[model samples]
Target chain A: MAELVKVVVDAMGGDLAPVEPVKAAVEAVKERKDILVILTGQEEVIHSELKKYQDYPTDRIQVVNATEVIETAEPPVFAIRKKKDSSIVVGLKMVKEQKADAFVSSGSTGAVLVGGQVLVGRSKGVERPPLAPLIPTAKGVSLLIDCGANVDARPSHLVQFAKMGSIYMEHVVGIKNPRVAIVNNGAEEEKGNALVKETFPLLKEAEGINFIGSIEARDIPAGYADVIVCEAFVGNVILKLYEGVSSELIHKIKDGMMSTLKSKIGALLVKPALKQTLKSFDATEYGGAPLLGLKGLVVKTHGSAKAIEIKHAIFQCVQFKQQRINEKIAEKIQPAQFPAPDKE
Target chain B: MAELVKVVVDAMGGDLAPVEPVKAAVEAVKERKDILVILTGQEEVIHSELKKYQDYPTDRIQVVNATEVIETAEPPVFAIRKKKDSSIVVGLKMVKEQKADAFVSSGSTGAVLVGGQVLVGRSKGVERPPLAPLIPTAKGVSLLIDCGANVDARPSHLVQFAKMGSIYMEHVVGIKNPRVAIVNNGAEEEKGNALVKETFPLLKEAEGINFIGSIEARDIPAGYADVIVCEAFVGNVILKLYEGVSSELIHKIKDGMMSTLKSKIGALLVKPALKQTLKSFDATEYGGAPLLGLKGLVVKTHGSAKAIEIKHAIFQCVQFKQQRINEKIAEKIQPAQFPAPDKE
Candidate 1:
């Protein structure tokens, strides 16, 4: 019917590996006729996994032989350089060479980040590609940019993050004129470290985006802003601690519910509604973190991602391609559009 | 009775100023005959609030007049210097003059931090004083040091923090040979930004502490380490985000439990057991954050603290005095005991 969006899936990556990846590719193809998936990994392993699925369009899915796999423990840059035939590297190269419209991986986060940059490369005028993930918040969800990509980012880098994040939230996440805010210890503009202080005024003066002021971490889960901007170090801490605190509390509540016979019966009554509410907050349901500003779309899902998450990540790439997020990012981050802040 | 540990309560501080602080002081003196409290604020306000409570030991609680009040919005350094007659300044000055063994406040965090360092002063060889708060964890509580003070910290400063945090945790929290870990994005030694990278090696080689390498933010809530060390910016994010995520999830759970009639009945049944279980994670139940390395103890309660939390903070000072936490810190952080790392 329409032009197919070709997405390369890393079959040998993540904890579940070929099983989950292959299953997800099949599920994706079954649901959507306007996409094709190229599963990259060891030929035999992928073929055997594919055999378990029947009655799928044989022509839509293809297997590309990749002899090696990049272990999570290996150094990312070295792994990307050495493992040319690995699924992560091969899939990224396919995107680089324009063979695929996008690439999806649940591999070593470090490797995916590096390969996404070194292979697919940054778009012209994009200073650095950032890994922007959609974290669930009380209102809905907000895009947290630069979560693990550039730990030591400069003021200009943060400025670009705000711009790119706004574009992403507006287009893919479909939030209109997404409010962008820089992460700070306090709500005041004068309350951040050197980078945030420098970037605050620039964000206020930046063009073509809805720039809100500084947001404290306490207001983050309340969803005060649609896009949360910070250096990778701060973003990583926020992301991980968000997961850590929520899971711990959930565990404690469950334990409390089962401590007594009355509460145990109560737990059964509230279980379905509670599960439905929490499901809205699940990160995996939102798919992968996209390494934005890349020449081609590249998404990195969790290393522990299951088949459902992989399927969502694949579907996510379709929207990214359809919405032309990269072109919008390129236009917004153009050097001519963003002037450097005056030196103090 | 043992020698009285005189504590100055800032009756002009916090959201519930003279009311809560005065009540807490009266409560503290009634609970412990070995402790005395000095309420510093407007004399009339302090006296009137105290008059509401009859039959409390009159001699144990005294009101010292402070004419000025420091608002939370005022710049910390300027307010501490100009507002000499403010309750915060007067109380800290009393501790400096040895008229009080400890100073407790539910006032502005910034003014308290600045006043603690400037008025109460640092101990010998203490490069910087850090704000260390005990955060609730899955197992129990862990001390998160430098949560708001020393935002732009150096490697040597963090090393001192680790040492100071270890001393406080082992002595005050009663955790013997407490495990100390620096916050990092990853678990590996080579996996941090400039600050964390430089501090990691120094922490490893430092003596008089049990060093447990790098800990990611995800492991923090699981009580992976007894003393969690980080510069203020990262630590602040972790602390605030920990609170943010937990409160939001708890709110969501309550809403979910009341969404339907069946669930509403179930919520009532689970209410008591859940409340008890969640109380263990309430931070105010533990007490205030102590500004370590000071000549006299200074504890900062939350700005929103009620009478109960203020009482707990006062009781916490009694333990600090009894355990000789300052003396232990003075011994542990001596420059001779902590050799500087070799310059790269």
Candidate 2:
């Protein structure tokens, strides 16, 4: 039998706290035979929540006491440094120490990013680790690299993002030779700001990845590219705007449907199909964003993530470890600057 | 009677070209007696299209001969420099020469921006001219400044954008002391890229405009601020993403609503209310982006603009001229630097 993949989850993080994390871990272990979960949080709180899950597999789940919790509002670097025993820090360290195959957190984004870098460390030859998330498009999903990690990114950084994103999409998301395009104002290479304009040619010449030319933001929803490369500022704006617009539109539609009796009947009839279609666009269905290029896997989900999203995020690590993605990433990223000393 | 507010229409621009431009001019002239439109294009083609409109106000609309047309694919600077007799260039020159109060084009955005700066010239003391467009929000419309004009914008340029956006909103849109906010990835002042971080404090301290600190992209549609300021790159992304996401959502909703017989009935029943609600968010209702801080107004509508949009854009010039927005912009922007050389 294959060895079990041990995953460390920050049970104290997120809005729902120990309840959702403990509940999700219980559900995950029951559903999968080759997975184990280590819940890092205050022992008493975790145990109390675990008791709520009856007929659970106690053997697959363990508890590690973390004395502190990192609040969302606190500064990330300082908090990571100061709160060494916090759930986030503890969970990340377990992955680094090889006690866990991966670390998952739905906590303060800054702290997760800081912890992922400082504690988990970067893979060999990784210049700047980027946060790549799968955003739902009309066709399916496209990976948005450097969504909020490297904001003031240079041209070189963007090229690396495209490379890493291509690796993720090809291996993990399972798209072959994914079409990669730089996000720009116009489709032409001459268009875009200094960063995009400079990065366009480098991406065009980069090895391995299928480099499509520039893509306008308006074409993003059409799923024109499998891998969308952009600096964090642009990526963040696109991601946030996508979320904002979808919710506002749904709100407006619901309001419109409820305004009249005839429409109300129509709403009831359409709710199931509309809900199903919207579910396809829901960010949670795709799981969390992996802080790619880390020495150990670190995934960050939304702060308000529920059991389903958390469950998907944890299972995501199983595939990540099975594929040995970090080794592949190190190989793809830097061929000469730094070679993996351990590899033959 | 008051002197006519002469407007220049680029009849050879946009996808519909002379047909839509001629039709729109006829409608504008019929709607408002105080406005006159100078249709600049191949005089024969425009006249032929004009003949389709029976009993049109011949006295209020006139045609001016412009021999060339600027294609959208042409490089903006090269096109502007070479296509001297193009409709865009001819219309802009009319505004510069004071033969027209404002210039309206649905042609290439690049050409319009280039000609607006070179031909119309910048208002004295204005560091850079920004293309400010009114985007539909849930509450109403908010002005997005520097949408595509100044890509690599400096902090000083953003301050001027905020000032100009404030002036346009208050004078034209009639929102007093309109709350102005800089678009950032996060709401925290320290949380943006280098450009936004540098621009924040300056906007906070800048006088005249109501600076409301940083606004996240997600909160934009909530109508949190009347003036949304950013460098052209970020602003353009926000605007395009807004367009992309809205259309995608509408498309998905329609598809979902038609997938089943029950939902189709619901779709038909809810069509009226939904259409009415969505019309409030339609961008064309707000007219074109006015390249703010120009000596004379230059409004750029979408290339796919129809007759109604063109008519609205032309009438928009009337209000801008009536309010003397340019003189006001100069007074507000450069009170300390130039002191308005010819001020009363």
Among the numbered candidates, top lDDT falls to 1
- State the DockQ of every prediction: 0.81, 0.74
Among all windows of 10 consecutive residues in model 2 chain A, the one with the lowest summed lDDT is A335-344
Per-residue CA lDDT of candidate 2, range A161-255, in tens? Answer: 88888888888888999999999887776788988878888887778889989888888888999999998988898898899888887888888
The worst-scoring run of ten residues by lDDT in candidate 1 chain A lies at A334-343
Model 2 TM-score relative to the real fold: 0.96
Candidate 1 lDDT over A1-344, as tens digits, reads 66899999999999999899999999999999988999999999999999999999879999999999999999999999999989999999999999999999999999999999999998987888889889999999999998965689988888888898998888888999999999998987778887888889889988888998999999999999999999998889888898898888888999999999999998988888898888877888888899998999999999889889889989888888888888888878867465656656
Chain B TM-scores across candidates: 0.96, 0.96
| lDDT, residue B277, model 2 | 81
Q: Please identify model 2 stretches exceeding 4 Å from their true place.
A: A335-344, B335-344
The CAPRI-style docking tier of model 1 reads high
lDDT per residue for candidate 1 within B153-245, as digits (tens), equals 899889889998888887777899999999988998888888999989889988899999988899999999999999998889988998899
- lDDT tens readout by residue for model 2, B1-344: 56799999999889988788888999999988989999999999998998888876799999999999999999899999999999999999988988888999999999999999999998888889999889988889999998865589998899999999998999889998999999888887778888888988888877788999988888888889999998998888888888998898899888988988888877888888888888888898888899988889999998988889889888889888898898888877864464335424
